[model samples]
Each structure stands twice: as C-alpha cells, then as structure tokens.
Target chain A: MSAAAAAAGLVLLAAVGACAGVVVGAAYVAFMNALRVPARLAALTYTRHMTRIYEAAMAAGAFLAAVWLVFPYTLRLAPAAAGFVGAAMGVYVGMLASALAETIGVIPVVARRTGLGTWVTRLIWFVVLGKITGSLIYWLYPPLVP
Target chain B: MPTVYLKPRDSLIVAPGEDITLGMLAEFAAEDHELERTLRGQPFLPGLTEGHGAISVSSLDLVRAIRRQRQDLDLRIVGPAHTVVKPRVRPNPVMAGIWTAAVTLLLFFGSLMAIMFFHADVDMPLVHRGVYQLVTGEAAPRPLVLQIPYSIGVGVGVLLFFNSLSRRKPSSDPSPLDVQMHIYDQDAQDYLVSQSAAAHRADQARQK
Candidate 1:
C-alpha cells in the first residue's frame, strides 16, 4: 500500500477500533461480574474491583486497537495474524464464558459441594482450550473465516 | 496504624530511605502515577516508596520490579517448573473481567454484521472507486481491497481475549496484603458511590 493509502486505511481502522472498543469493554464487565460471588462482597469493594478490571481490559484492548489501526491491507496479509488475533480473543472469550457458567450457573447449581477453587481451575482450562482452538483455526484457514 | 498492599513489582520512589502513606500516595499519584492502561498479574497498582510514603515511580524501579515478578512466568525445560500461566486455575476476578471482554466483542460483531447485511447490495467497489478518485486522483479499479485489512483487524480484538488469561503469571505468591491502601479515581469513586447507594436502598427494602 502507498503511504497515502496506508494513512487513510489507518484512519478508517482507528475509527473501527474505537467503535469496537465499546463492545469489548462491556463484555469484560459482564465476565467480571460472573466471576464474582454475589451477596458476599460489599458494593463499594465490588465496584472497586470492577473498575480495576475495566481499566485492565481496556488497557489490553489498546493493543488490539493499534493492531487494527495499523493493519496491513497489502494482499500479502499473513494468515498467521489471523491465528494470533483469534487465539488472543478466543482465550479472552472462553475465559469470560467459563466464568459465567461457573460463577452464575454452576455456582448456583452446585455451590455447596464444589469449591470455588475447583471452579476457577476448570475455567482457566476452558480459556486455554479457546486459545488453542483459535490458533489452530487461524493456522489452518486464516482467509475468509467463519 | 495503616495497612498497605505492596506488590513485588512496585518500584520504591523514596530516595534510599523514606516512608509511604496515604497522603504521600495521593501527591505522588497526581504528579506521576496514573492508572495502568491494562491489567498485569504483577501489582503495578499503588507502589510503595522504598524509603518514604511518597508515590513517585523512578523508571528503573518500576521496570525492575515488574520484570522480577514476570520472571517466574517463564516456561521450564527440564526442572520442575511452574507453567507460564500460573495458579493452575481461574480466579473469580479474572473470570468476571474476561467475560465482559467477550460480550463486548460479540456486541461489536453484531454491529458489523448488521452494517454489512443492511447494505448487502451496495457495491463497496464502486464506493471505493469514487472515493479513491476524489481523494488521490488514482483510477485504480481495485481500491476496495482497503476493507480487507480492517476485516482482519477483528482478529486483534480476539487475540486480546486470549492474552488476558496469560496476563497474570501463576505463582505461590501471596496477595500483597502486607500493604493496604486504596487510591480513589473519579471513575472508581463514582462507581463505588452508585453501588453504595443501590445497596442502601436495598437494605431499606429488606428492613421494611
């Protein structure tokens, strides 16, 4: 891509990234709430923790935004980049999904017998699986994805 | 008299010998320290002054301390090594944070789909050609390939989700309870106040 084209593409990508940020941020918040045990922690502490998580999630998103903003539009865009992005996001998504199931779903179902510790372990594994799957998908077929 | 939370990653700012306190932390916060843009397992939040209560972050210290904590995350080859991903499990805090990101990604996807589907018949090529000529005076036929990279950019968002898991290295490291101080930012404070008000209202209902 020419410099001018590259610059224009960056501006467009930046706008997209800024717009996508809202979604990524909200998902992080929901995931965090799911991870916590309700009716235990005080509201202030909970908010504090949530704010911390929000900041962290956004910080991570900045990198994503940069990647998007500077995405090489050259037809030579590598397929591996797909896996790289997929693995990062997939792990993140899987982590949130697992947290929702355990904290909200399983916690209510079997909160008594299974310890929080056990739930957390399973959740981590779930996210790891997501990263692996995304990476595999990107490596195998980075172009024209589902 | 006070509790302070110290992470191994905190770089002490006091010259060789000073104390750290809430007031000093506030001053230091205003001058130098701002909230971290992202989350890392190593405690970069509210670092203690090496010698004083001041919160100034010397570049060397922040750099050195955080690196020290991350070193434990390296993978081992032969020796009994803790996996780079630590604690071997998900913490509630981490889980809640991650789910929010996923949901956010989903929402963005929905929006993207809605945009494209809403305009299915629109030839992005024609649009691109028109803009390309207007902007650069180039008569290129395939200026529409510009959208390809942006599409791929979605993967970057996806990658962030995966890295969140790896953000904190698992360790036998205990919570930095040895130090306990809370810094209030406007956003955090506002959230706390709103939640507190909600709790108070709920409590009144329960009492009634």
Candidate 2:
C-alpha cells in the first residue's frame, strides 16, 4: 500500500477499534446490571480488566521487538510502530471508561439484593465483558502467540 | 439485582441481635426479642449492613463504587505505594525515557559536531545548506541536529515512566471503614471475643 494509504487505513482501524471498545464495554455493563452482581466485586473485576490491558501492551511491545529482530527492515517502520502503541492506549482508555461508568451506575444497586441464581447469572456476565475486551484487543493487535 | 454492597474486609460480624441502633440487618431481622439476651455486651458484632447478596459481585465493580465515593481512596493506596518505593533521588521514568533517547541522539550529535568542528568538507553537497534552509526557513539542509532526537527520546521516556508510576500509587483509604472489616479472618475474631466473654461467664458462675 502507498504510505499515505497505509496511514489512512491504520488511522481508520484505530478509530474503529476505539469505538468498538466503548460499545463492548457499555454492553457488558448493561448485561452485568441485568444479572445484579454486587458493586464492590464488580469494581474489582473491572480494575483487573484494566490491568490486563496494560499487561497486554507491555507484552505486545516485547513481542514486536522480537519480531522486528526476526524480520529486520520492519524495525525501521518506527513511526508506524509508535502509532500502533498510541492506538492501543487510546482504545484501552475508551473501553475502560465506558465499562467503569456502567459498573458505577449499576453495581451498587445490585449489591443490595440477595439470591444464588442471580449471583450465577452475574458471573456469566463478568466473563462476557472480559471476553469482549479480549476480542477487541485481538482484533486490533493480533497477538503473536507462537 | 439490588446493588448495596458489603465491603468485604478482615474484621466485622453481625448477629441477629447485635445492633443496638439496628443499622445493618438486625433492623431487618423479624424476631428481636428471641435474640436479645444472647446479644448483650457482645463486644463487637459489627457485620455488614450491605449483606451477602453482593456475593457474586466482581471485585472490580466494588472498588469502582467505593472509589467514586472518594477520590482520596485511590490516591491513598497507589500514590503512596509508588512514592514509598521511589528511589530517594534517582531519575524518574520521564527523565529516563528522555535520557535514553538523548544519549542515543547525543552520540549522533557528537559525530556531526565533530564533522562541523573539524571535517568541514567545503566541497560537500549543499545538502547541509538545504537542511539549514528547511529548519531556519531559509534555503538549507541543516545538519541533522542529532542532539534533538536524543533529547526528544529522553523526554518521552521520562513522561511514560512517570505516567505509569502515577498509576502504580497506593490509592486512598477512602473508606477508612475498610481496614477494620478485612484485617482479620472472622473465625479468629469470633474466638477472641468468645474467649474474653467465656472468662467473664466463668467469673459470674463462681460468684454463684
């Protein structure tokens, strides 16, 4: 692809990833509330989710560095590499805020109630949110899982 | 689902007749009289008013809600954690990133500076002149000021290090209410209280 075309494509991809991250995050919150998990535990799960994103970032860089050594010339694409880093951070922040907001609005209310069936349902929703975030990261970064 | 949350901590217990003001759930318990005699001077029967419903709540959601209640909450924990661990007067992350970039850049800068200072090949292409023009908005190819790149890298590294460090801090004990509930396991606590109470009971029985 032409350099300009590549830049445009990457930019559009970043924007889409960021938008999708927000949507996925919001949907998970709605789903969590419908299940009624306690607010405090929900918040901890959310914080862990954020931590996972940062971990992914550190890992991605290490992987990329390894790949660059293998592929050689690819390392010279420094600007594009930096841009990808920025995009990941941007997407992470977007999704994280949306997810937390959902938790803030609903988790506290859920904490007040009682029931085992409801608790089980909430657990499923927590996993769903985590999966959504993970999928989004995969789509954007494409983990090098050799 | 109702969202009231019990802050799960190390300390605190609630029995049916424990609350004098009936704050957590004694207020909700139907039969107060049946439990009154057993609850007297129970020392500390403080159980969560928020209750067990939030049992399914993920740990993150709980923190977010508590966090919102007090910004100080995060600052108390992560901020302090970072501060305490920070080396007494070393280069921070932001400085480090800049330094790495700067040092790399300086090497290149020194080479070019040597060229300018001594290897001033007058016959060389006006490329350097073009660089000058571009940089100064005149007609020049200014020597790639290698120092600039190093400084920029150093600046960026330091910025990143500090940003991450800030997040690593110990956030607030927003709910100073937390330490009391979580610091001890419930059974150990119950044993302690019962041991003290048992001594009192034995003393009373002896008087009889």
Candidates' lDDT values, in order? 0.37, 0.33
- Compose the digit string of candidate 1's lDDT tens values, residues A91-112: 3333343333333333222221
- Estimate, for each residue in B1-208, the C-alpha lDDT of model 1 and write its tens digit: 1112223222223333233322222211111133221112234344333333223233334445534644432221221111111112223677555654554344344334433432234443454344344434455564423333323333332333223323355342211110011121223334544564576679889999
Q: Name the docking class for model 1.
A: incorrect
Off by more than 4 A, model 2: A1-88, A91-104, A114-134, A137-146, B1-13, B17-208
lDDT of 2 by residue, B1-208 (tens): 1122232332223342333221221111213444332222222223324333111112343345344543432211111100000011223567555544544344334323322322124422242233233234433222224222322332232222112212333362111112222232233355554564576579889999
Question: Model 1, DockQ value?
Answer: 0.03
How does chain A of every candidate compare to the true chain A by TM-score? 0.35, 0.28
Quality of candidate 2 docking, DockQ: 0.02
